[model samples]
Target: MSKLKLDLIKNSISYFREAVAYAQRDELDETRWKFAIINVVQAMELAFKEKLRRIHPALIYSSVDERTDTVSLKKALNRLVDPGIGGLVIAEKDPRKIETAVKLRNELTHFECEHEHEHMEAKFADIFSFMIFFYREHLGLETEEFIDYDEHQRIIGLVKARAELRTRARSYIKAENFIDVWICPSCDESTFVAQNGECCFCHHKEAVIECASCGQETLESNVIDTSNYLDWDYDEGRMVLMEDYGMEMTACQGCIETFKSKVEDMRQAQYYEYMEREAMSYSR
Candidate 1:
């Protein structure tokens, strides 16, 4: 790769960082939000061109009327997949994300429309992952380390939250199986639904736990609740929150109530036994 192409890649990364920063700002600033979309697409466009250039410089541009014309982003991406190019293939990358970001940029640039903060956030969330993966795969860089960790996490949270709201409104998805889906506690989206125990979007493992009584798998939160049954270490039987392995036993709601009732009955029996013994002692 020529130093010139490497420089372009560097500039594209800079633009991507700026886009993310602007996107994370207060959405009330319409200009900032708009710039975020614009910068995101531009970053992808430049980064893609750089990758193509690395494979073959002519892949990036065409000579037109003594002036160089950069190839379309879509064309550049299509060419990158060619086996002969053989530089870095974004084989597993989702094309829809880049296409959507480009479409959004064109819409924002040419026309007037309500670019809702929530919509932009969701779109950017997908783009964010796309860019990170591209940089990691092609440039061998950990792009996240270059940004503010806390701020980046906050932006990701907002984006996923917006995506969750959209997923909830999708009645078709909800009709599948009520218990089969859950709003991920980490990403807070149906997008977090994991097949192999891993969230594809955020890469967090799906936190599933088995109901101690029912023996059915459920979201960890659904199974965790306050129980009246006390731990043995406590002097008095007081209600305390318990979960698997946190105490000697943890049970689902129905079982916990049954266990509590049994404990109470046993305590009453023990009291009656003491009273009977005292009466016999007095009689003697």
Candidate 2:
């Protein structure tokens, strides 16, 4: 292995060990938990780069041709999940959890943010569990190589606690008959109540908007603004509105697909009508 690759593997293991030590501490104050999160995120980034490096040394760079800087965690993840490249299949839900962890790491590192201790603990547990699997299955590390037996058991305990916490939250939401419950993007828990526009488990709130096309509620971030798709006619010096193809200004994912199909049908009909007119003109 090249020196860079060796250093990456060494540093990643060290960071993961430090994170595990912090997580196993009996007296975990705010500082300790913060360190735990920071170290683990660093480990994940380095490990992802190491995998990319193995695939192609240039794969770790932001620009393969320029080679000016290393790739960001998000970019690295996108590359890793690309079927033609890394071929790593991440679980659908896990990607959202990983995104949440990355955001939390950034907030705790560069800015001031407050979070409940339980919520932080849950985030750490999810990352820890996923990292362990990644190290063993993806990196081909033996159990004893990256983690000691006792440390492994402690990590398992943490993961179990997180799972139990989620179960209780789900039961509470169900008992209360919260009809608008959905999986929270923040905590990866199914405790986000659409009616309340907040996650009951983690207290994370997001803007909720009703889809103009389907009339169903969705996250404001997930809605597509369809105004950009409107057709226009440039007549004289001014542009005039031509057609909207019967689409709403905003739509949900399902409605967007339907609108696209309708537009394609309209385009084909217009094409056939033009062909018929041309045929008549030629015949005449």
- Among these predictions, the greatest lDDT belongs to 2
Candidate 2's error at 56, in angstroms?
Answer: 3.4
- TM-scores, all models, native as reference: 0.54, 0.80
The models' CA-based lDDT, in order, is 0.66, 0.85
TM-score of candidate 1 on Cα atoms, chains taken together = 0.54
lDDT of 2 by residue, 1-284 (tens): 58998899889999999999998777546676787888998999999999999899999999999998999999999999999889999888878888889999999999888877767777888888889888888888887888899998988987887778778878988888989887776788888988889887778789988889888888776688776666778899988768777767788875888867777788788789999999999999
Error of 2 at 212 (Å): 1.0
Give stretches of model 2 more than 4 Å off: 22-28, 115-118, 176-178, 232-242, 267-284
Query: Would you list the clashing residue pairs of candidate 1?
Result: none
Off by over 4 Å in 1: 1-3, 63-67, 86-93, 144-146, 166-172, 175-284
